[model samples]
Target: MIMPNEQKAPLVHLANAIGTMSEVSSRVGQYVLANPEKVVHQTVAELAEYTHSGQASVLRLCRQLGFKGFSEFKLALMAELAASERSTATDSDNEADRYGALLKRLTQSMQKTAYALHAEQLLAIAVHMVKARRISVFGSGISGLVSQLVSYRLMRLGLPAQAFQDPVLAHEVMTDVDKHCVALGISESGVTLDTVEFLKRARTAGAKTIAITGRVNSPVAQAADLVLLAVPIEPLTIGGDISPAISKIYLVELLAMAIADLSHAGRQRNERSKTP
Candidate 1:
């Protein structure tokens, strides 16, 4: 059955992953990029035939791009196509059209990231924060801003939190982290060496580690006891390199809200205990 145009696919995501995939998967990705409409309508076998690749390779490509299979990939393409068609259905260069396209892209970043993250993991992180002696946030570059913002939010909630942007100070502070603390690392790429090192040191010191990153399999994610996936905004999007920050902010805000709820619950318990 044909899916609705409102459904969104991650075409740009596939394109980006292709750059890191093996030759066979890259071939499949390139084929889809070159003929999205045709590939979407065709079966996986047909796509494999057209790309001169095996059906397994096509499936592998879909999974690599975070799809369940070719069917899911096609559905996403259909959604992208639908969005594209709507944007172009009108032929005028009006301000509305320009702004509409911009809004769509920005919302897409949040939707995609939200879909990628699991609620259970987020709740677990909140619980960890509720139980921790302190929460230390670490990031660099644009992620540094995210780290600081999250730290401030935690503090506003009456939690002991700090943001570390400098590698030297991060190392120095991490040296004092103990098992009672929580170490949270934010990295869009998940491979930032300094951030990963901080996480490692924190873990060695027995602190509970959490990683917020776009890459599920990244080193930072691998090192953390808990992983919170955030949708990465493409640099080529409407806002350039700052685009991905939207998704990061979205995930952090959710984390903050969750932590707040946990804190509220704790306060309620304390009040009830006092009454008894």
Candidate 2:
């Protein structure tokens, strides 16, 4: 029952969640990761036995990775294996192989992040933008670029939006953000102290807060009223320490598009009302 879903990567996603998975689940994940080629051709019961865990544990692991069940997980695994095998056929030059691997990593991370985000949440964030008096976007380092990117998109829609890269200045502005403002914090780690502080202070001032971060349980998410999860995959870059999650850009683009549609609809309605 291999489904060979080209749009999703089960192995990539499972690896990402392995860090925070339970002991039993981690064991199951490690087994599949270590022997993906073997596991792809095995039955559910066999995999469970191989991992020294039960069938339920195997099934549970599948669900946690956002698959319907074992069959779906197997399908995705088979597809990933097939794709990897195709890539391997072109390993003539070592440098090409390395470049291909990094390219695949970046693509897979973006795909997983796009797959993980929910449309309802994106729409909800858009709804907030449509109703807010002003928008404040916060991020540091690479996330700062994402913040500014999204802020510009919002401005293009004629929404009152501003990007705040400086935490000190952001903090000063947060004081003026009443319940009418929507404060968005973009962080790859979600634990950036300055960004988290901005969200906390924004909430304290009765502003609507939203966090777009890779960590679901991070301080920024905990402080904000809404959380949008993205992949923390970063490029091997020369910038400072690590670059911001590339997934952040994808999510913000999705947000901007959603907000645009909502903003357009709202404007049309307003014009219609005035015409009467």
Largest TM-score belongs to which candidate? 1
Compose the digit string of candidate 2's lDDT tens values, residues 94-162.
887877766675676576566556577789989998889989999998788889888988898888999
Off by over 4 Å in 2: 1-95, 234-245, 274-276
Per-candidate Cα lDDT values, in order, are 0.77, 0.78
Model 1 weakest 10-residue run by lDDT: 1-10
Candidate 1 residue lDDT tens string, 108-176: 667656655556779998988878898899999888988998898889888899999999999999888
Clashing pairs in 2: 3-75
Report the lDDT of model 1 for residue 261: 84
